[model samples]
Target: MAKWTTENPAFVDTWFSLFRLGQTKKQFNAADTIKMSELTFFNPLSSKDNLKIEATLIADTIDKVFSSWGAKLENSISRNTAINDMIQILLDEDKTIKDLAEKNDENYFFTNEIKLENES
Candidate 1:
């Protein structure tokens, strides 16, 4: 799984809480709190959209953090390429498995259980 090391747990918790409240209460304003938390976390350094300025700052902060850890964005992209390649291979294999299941009258299993079994 891809990891984001600089993610703030408290911020995430609050974001989720706001999202859940918005869903349960059907209040559109609850999204404002979530958006604010996102802006606080992803403040970009430069952005054309004033609404996204905070997010730009946060992105700049994350870039700096990654640089300090010796993992720049380019290196992260390279790593992600490898991960995507692996995912594509797995998806192809899953298609093959589904074909076999269809042929055998077992139907195609698309659940986590099947994926975990295939992995093992």
Candidate 2:
């Protein structure tokens, strides 16, 4: 089983601390920054599975929480571009889609989607 584990206390503390801060702020702050040293241990380029899990969690939250708030988050280009870039980086590292695919017992799939057409 692939799992994400970080031994860095500073990284975990700062992340959740900022998340708590954002939960109370009336205006969104985009100036949040991270230290390079702190980020080095969890580099997406060096940890494909970690990046995939992070991306999936962000996606799941957006789908379950933000989908009903006007526009669905999955329709945003920036979100898709970020995930796509991660997928490309994983491919560059020789990680196949199958390796990242979510498993269902004995089977695995990249994704499952349903598109409804308009009946006019």
Pick the TM-score winner: 2
For residue 85, what is the lDDT in candidate 2?
44
Per-residue lDDT for 3-81 in model 2, tens only? 2122322222223323443421211122123322122223545566775665455334433332242322233345455
User: Candidate 2: where is the Cα deviation over 4 Å?
Assistant: 1-27, 30-46, 73-120
- Taking all chains together, the TM-score of candidate 2 against the true structure is 0.28
Candidate 1's residue-wise lDDT over 1-120, tens digit each?
Answer: 212111422222223333443322323323322223232222344343542443233333433333353432232344344333323322231222122112211211223334556899
lDDT of 2: 0.31
RMSD of 1: 16.2
Candidate 1 positional error at 72, Å = 3.6
Model 1 has how many clashing residue pairs? 12
Off by over 4 Å in 1: 1-48, 74-120
